[model samples]
Target: MIKKVLSFAVIGVSTVTLAIGLSPNTASAALGDQPEVFHSSYNPGKSTVTISTSNTEKKPVKASGYLSKYFKGYAHKAKNGKWQFHLDGYGDAEGLYNNVRNDQTVRVYLSEGKEQGAFDVKVKTIVKKNKVKKKKAIKISKAINGKNVKIKNNKRKSDVITIKKVSKNDKITIYNAKGKRLVQKTAKGNTIKIYVRQLGKKAGAVNVSTQKKGYKESGKIKVKYGRE
Candidate 1:
């Protein structure tokens, strides 16, 4: 019997090597094993590349056909200064992983307002000519009684703050007694000139800003005397 056919071919090769060493896929990786295929490349501004693995079961990684979700078409320089973005073509690369994988990191998103910096692509510079200089028109006056206060510029011109109240309607305002309202004019017709600088503030503790511009009608007067 040829030793029973060599003992049944050595027990069928040791039961197929003990069923491939107790197979689970050859078991060994565990702690968050993630990997099926992962690749990357970015220059839209400079750096970011990822791929994970710890082998705890759960795999799905296929994005290595050439990895081009666009950026080979080139045109980067964005971060809210002027604007320019063009990654022309390329697809597939956006998220989804199961069983809490171990090392999977490849995320780059910047092109809508632009912001995600470590580097991927950002080259900027273009402003040929823009000097900027035009704001000269300032003339201030105060002569209710006169004490020499009439700063003039004519180029920075825009003034009006007249308050002549003898019967009623003298409620004016441009306060700063913590009432804070740099400028607010509303004395439309009873001689409430208000246009001081732009809308109100010929003095500091101005009163009656209640015509509804900041509400400071608490009472204050001395609109500054002695000045022509």
Candidate 2:
């Protein structure tokens, strides 16, 4: 049986660091830090959005203007480079981005101080999760520690283990406690199921992770399970 040692949700950040311009110099050059969009989270109750960013040097960065359609604000920074917006479609926050719904695509551009050029666009789908109050101990496994390729929740009401969906065609590999391969396959629908009988009896614990192209492979996350 696989037992969960803790109860929590996986909070993660996705980063995009590409810049575009009409001319050569502007495309690659900037006086400012040219911050990278770290992650974004939404609040349904308050209708607020917080965009977090960090610069190349991690010193600090500033936004001179809002050139995008969904958000608008001036000199937007308090500390640690967090810009705030409300989704009312008036004043600071524009509502047409109301189209940026769960599983819906949202496009954001990063421009630098005082010079606005045609931006190379990168479209990202921001998926939001709603919190559910539970009284019993959670059933799923979490990241063994703060590491990449988290074991996302797919076992809430299941007896077996599951990995959260990954991008199509990516590989999902599972291993035994002592480091032996039990199952390996490509994600056709972007998700995989963990079966106890397939892994056999000696898999006291298992490690789960997916293959990220071009990035180093990670399979260090531990999922504690035992034989009956």
Candidate 3:
């Protein structure tokens, strides 16, 4: 009877060893010889691409082809365990649409040990159109017409011009008679002040203009300056 019990215990040990050998961990160790696997996703209307590795290791990857060609920086893994790449530019939506079509492929390169592997990821559908904010037209205050303004020869002093109907995004520019930019500032409120000074002893005319996106440029306004 003791011999029979010993035989059963030996068989149980052997069965457990066999099961451990067939576990997923053992199979994944052999993945170094297998092909690299990756999954890719993209955000609509944004220039972000996320790539995840099937294997949980933090391996570096290089992205190429399609919109990836215009990426400004190298791809890096984020805290969320996914690799992120960005397509950088002011007109991201238009540029992305022109560079990549529907169902395009992006090449991803990876290094496994001393060997290198590559795979292609199909691009996801992205919204081609991005909403753009319309710019507001800049309006000048009638209080300060571009005519017969007083100026001081003192470089330390400046003449302040009040502007009206200003947007936060509007930029105010002051130009001399020679078309040289003297001062440029962004508007912070409905009114902004433009300071003008005489760089030389002689009095001259200064032009003021307002600039913003999507809005017609405020034409140059001529203001006469004389020694105070």
What is candidate 2's CA lDDT for residue 108? 40
lDDT of 3 by residue, 3-33 (tens): 1111223644552222223456556665554
Candidate 3: lDDT of 52? 34
Clashes of each: 34, 1, 0
Question: Which candidate should be chosen as best, given lDDT against the real structure?
Answer: 3
In Å, residue 122's CA in model 3 sits off its true spot by: 38
Off by over 4 Å in 2: 1-160, 194-203
lDDT of 2 by residue, 73-92 (tens): 22223488533222122323
lDDT of 2: 0.41
Better of 1 and 2 by lDDT: 2
Q: Tell how far residue 227 is off in model 3, in angstroms.
A: 1.2
Name the TM-score of candidate 2.
Answer: 0.27
Q: Which stretches of candidate 3 lie over 4 Å from their true place?
A: 1-155
**Worst 10 contiguous positions by lDDT, candidate 3:** 89-98
